[model samples]
Target chain A: MELIIDRLTKQYKNKIAVDRISLTLNKGVYGLLGANGSGKTTLMRMLCGVLKPTSGEVKFNGIDVSQEEYRDSLGYLPQDFGYYPEFTAYEFLLYMASLKGLAKQSAKDKAKELLELVSLSDSAKKKIKTYSGGMKQRLGIAQAILNNPKILILDEPTAGLDPKERVRFRNLISQLGTDRIILLSTHIVSDIENIAGMILIMKDGQIVHKGGLDEIIKAIDGRVFECTVDAGEAGKLISMHTITNFRQENDKTFLRLICDKSPCENAISVKATLEDLYLYYFKEVNTDEKLF
Target chain B: MDNNIKRKLKSVFEAPMPAKKDDFLNQLDYPKASRLDFIKSQAGYIRKQVWVLSLLLFIGTLILMYYFEVSDSVIWILSSALPFISLVSIGEIFRSITYNMDELEMSCKHNFLEISLIRFGILGLANLAVLISLLILLAGKTDFGFFRLGLYLTTPYLLNCYGSIFAVNRLKNREIVYVCGVVTASVSILNALFTTQINDIYTDKYWSFWIISFIILAVFSYKEILKLIKKMEELKWSLSLTV
Candidate 1:
């Protein structure tokens, strides 16, 4: 049940959307975190076999990505997908089930079961055009898993979800991750913060960091500093450091920032959080990585 | 809420039932859909507009047959619309890609081509049905007998097919394929008007030429369709690679 991506690279004319990247995964939930245009979608597309790589390949066990048997184990939800406006939610899932080679009666039962799982059973008979964005995204999630795929890939699956819906979606994903390989890509750091067993932080078309949350946070451990300064001094510190947070109390301002060397006399070192680690790794200017 | 509705609501928010989950995966008795099932489902999805248009074409044919004495010119004019119907039927097959379902369809185990071909066959049958009905309406009334009627009817329809299949491979926008169809139908009509074959069907002089031309166009159309399928898959995969 191992999925191996070997040196996958996609180039368009002079620009490289996804640079050479490789990874291997078994059954678990892995989060791909990156800013826009950072190649998360591109990599996920390659994994799902919707897009081919220019120089490398993805294999499920030993089977090629282009092979039908490999696809039989795959379920993918792209960043942008369309549904037939005329189709009822149940009908749409049935169509997708057929495309995946499911038996007709089983497909119908599966469609009913999935719509219920996604909490769309009440509206399964209604046309999709009448559904809201969150409902549609839930439907998207349901269809991606209708085949009971061994490998499920979702790109920005929470884009249109509300806060509560996002939480429900995360719980669903966390439960599914115990047996299957689930790879989800998103820029929302917190969306994956609680559920993902491992995180891959990407930047400039490459994975700059890959590890468990605590391990990655350890990289910036001694670098985060907390200090209180007056308005005039806070302005000076802001110019010279990457400020993660700041709030004014009394006449002084409390500031949290990342720096190799302390920016002020009273600044005390604090533990690094995932957000701080993210800012440290992907801020406008590249930072020194003396700590691994 | 009723007690039953309340229970259903509670179940929806709870974890998916374990029994249903196992049944979904372990149901080996579930038979895979045969080719006939695919064809049936494809036919089920055919657009309602196609049915409406087919009815209108039939009514139009009936009216024209009742009023005008069937002649080569009348047969030629009525047959012009057949090319457009053929174009529309093919357009229906391309509708999924137009609506952005191509990405999802291509990623499935069966892939896009299989579903597309099934839908194409269904629509192709609809197109055939309309053509045959038109021929039957003109069967006894027109001096243009079976062979000649078949030639006139097939020539333009085949030309439309050829033009559409050829354009689809080269053009990015699906609308351009319709433009190719318009050109094909126009040329066929103009040729039928001036060419002596339509007026002198009794003579065997041009029978061989028409049969030969029809065969050549049909072969070219089939090859173009194959090319269109290959080109579409290649382009999508290549575009994905570069994107």
Candidate 2:
């Protein structure tokens, strides 16, 4: 199902959390990349009907979200998900399934199946309090998918995961997104770099960029460059260029920086990445306002 | 036989249902599952409070029985008060931990209507329990007139109980409820101590004063409840818009 968010805004007293922003999402994995407090979480919460918007509407296939029916196909994992500490992983998933209106036998069956899918079947009987951070995240993912929801919203789904578990979780989400609209919100760009079918970048409560991965990369097509400089000069180079990475070896520094055109004598042109585009847009937007 | 069991287990794990995207949208329109969904969702928290309150009440009952060295009359009081106190305290504790609408919105199965009803029902039952205990005490004296007085007092108790739960849920905070519970408990104890005088006053022309007071309190409570419900509806609407 398609999820459409139109002119959504959330205001808390004098501060605006989400400005009037609109976007339409189709079935696929979409990365919602933004800095912290950039309204990414607010937008996600609004989509799941957890937080009320100051104005505007969120709809699934033209059905307004305020209707309880719209929430049935929606699943969300908030950044700070609270679970009953005394419940076993199995029990917790079962409880979530019931909330989603699954039949008793179906909920039990789905809980067991999802536990296996997230690779937590071995510890399914263990209380949630005893779980490690990565394990809890895996359980969160499991519960989010227990109802086989059509629209899945996960906020920082890989925040505390180890590298290996992070990769596995991403793969699982990638598989799930083939038939559902998956909006993965994170401050970490790399989490969605390879998997996202579309990337929407948010800044100051507005979507600054939205398109496919290659299209976003194309936004800064000839901006990235790499060069070797003396170790002492590397700091000076960063002031003039968008230095993405720096490696020091044998008293020389290899710097991967970004500029509209080549800036150094020995600089080699390189293809732009999602990270380069994100930093470039955000940096440009910030600089235009004369704010460091 | 073991091999057959193992095969069955493997088959259970391997089975997949082809991921039928059933219409969750339609199901949301279905009648909400049960009022117990709220209690069940808060079961873990309720169990803890029940355990602690039950233990304390049990010990207090034993000590009172031993110290008074009275007949079945004393046992009767202990038996009545023990369960009533334990149940009310447990209900209060559950209400305290589970009143946050944000948390309930996240964890429970019911919609806002069902959730409010469950909260009101629990608080109502607790208040009813206290009223019943007072009635039983009057019965212990074989005073039907006093029993009738206690029954009459239930009208105010029920009104206050509903008002408190409604107020707490609308604010989505439990501190107010805690303060009210303490105040009401203290007042009830004081009232019980002066029951005979209060009953005498009720029989005289002062009965009209109590009736008028009850009417004023009920009106004020009704107004407060309506305001709270309006605020909650607004809150829910604004929240939906943001999403």
Candidate 3:
């Protein structure tokens, strides 16, 4: 199935949260990369019909996002989600399944199967209040796919996951990507660097870059430079350009900087990674801490 | 060997394994629930403590009625307390909204309003059932007749329901429900205190006034309920977009 987002825009009283953005998606995984408050949540919320656009609309295979039919084919996991603390893992999934319109027996079976899939079968009977942050995130992921939706939207799905759990989630998402349109929004570069077929980079409520991973990386080709200089010179270079990484080795400092031209003497050009491109665009914003 | 034979015989008698074990996976049609099924499932999420408290209150009132000389003052006092049972339910309706689950539920197939309305109806029915039981118990025990019993029981309950529903619809904040609930309940209690005499309600003059007032509150509540449902539907899309 194909999903079309047409000129979607959301404006608050004074500031626009999501500028006019239009794109089409199909059966593949597309990673949405942006800093916090860059409108990723707003865009995803509009796609799921949770937030209405000011001037444009979203449709999936000719079905409007506001329609019940569109919602039937859609699954979404918001950045900040809440659960009934009293509900067991199994009960929460079953309740969500019922909301998604699953029959009673089908909901029961699916909840059981998903609990096992998320490796929470051992805690299926435990209350959600007893779950860890990572386990709750896994439960969120399970519920998003409960309907086997044609379009899945996950906002910061891996926020609380450890490295091992992150890899496991990535593999599960990659597996599910082959049959449905999955749009995953995350500030973590490594989470999507290997799995996403395409990356959409947002900055200041606008999509600054959208294409294949290599194609988008090509935007920063020859602009990323690595150099070793004196600590004083390194500090000077850090102020002159966007420094993505810095390390002190003995009396010398090694730095990875993004610049249009070489910022220091004997600076060596390096291959541009997704993180380099991210820092290049969101220069004033600090996204390095969010990296895996 | 005997256990194996028995197992084999039982397997043969069973219904052919119901096709492949993964057949249910293929049978996964878009999950659609009827209204009855939806209400039943929604009812599962209602706080169990509310029911326990309602039952406790009922038992406590029954004990009082059995031990003391039941009067209109007692019935009036008991009716004023019923709205507290409904306060728990109104709180449940806004739990998801207050806790940041509104966006998630809004994106679901059944949507937020459908779920809220179902929970509201469940509590409404429960409150109704409790009212009827109390009416039956107090009808024969006291000099208060059917009209007085019905009017006394319904007034506070309807006032609370209408006020809570109205506040939830008009206000963006979920906390207003508690404020509205307190105001409604307090008013009901104060009114009950002032109208304690059975002779006051038994007269033709005040009986017609109470009946007319009941009709007006009932009509206003019905209209406000429709408005609340419509407001909830509109709010699903608009609430998050606003600042």
Instruction: Report the number of the highest-lDDT candidate.
Output: 3
Supply the global lDDT for candidate 3.
0.83
- Candidate 2 C-alpha lDDT tens digits along B1-243: 699998999888886765544434323433333435536654433345544554565566457545765333443343334333423543443342343334324422344444444554554565456456545544444333544455345434534444454545454333565645654564444444444344454354566665665677667766775665665445452343333
lDDT string, candidate 2, A1-292, tens digits: 6788899998888888889998889989999998666888888877877666889999998888867677667777867665655689998887676667666677777788889988999999999889999898888888777667778989899988998988898888887888789999886788889678999998888998889888888877888999998866788888887767889878888999888887678989998888887777677654665564
Best by TM-score: 3
Candidate 2: where are CA atoms >4 Å away? Answer: A284-292, B1-109, B122-130, B133-148, B151-217, B220-232, B235-243
Alpha carbon lDDT of each predicted model: 0.81, 0.67, 0.83
Candidate 3: chain B TM-score equals: 0.79
**Candidate order by decreasing DockQ:** 3, 1, 2
- Model 1 Cα shift for residue B68 (angstroms): 3.2
Chain B TM-score for the candidates in order: 0.75, 0.48, 0.79
Clashes of each: 0, 9, 1
Q: Model 1: how far is B82 from its true place, Å?
A: 1.1
Q: On residues A1-292, what C-alpha lDDT tens digit does candidate 3 reach at each position?
A: 8899888898877788899899989889999999878889889988988877887889899999989999989889988788876789898888889889998887888889888999999999999888899999999999998998889999999999999999999999998897789999998998889779999999878898999988999988999999999978988998789888999899899999999998877999999999988888887675455463
Report the Cα RMSD per candidate: 6.8, 7.0, 5.2
lDDT of 1 by residue, B37-150 (tens): 766776777889887888788888898878877766666666566777776777777776666777787778877777787777778777778878887888778766766788
Candidate 1 CA-lDDT value: 0.81
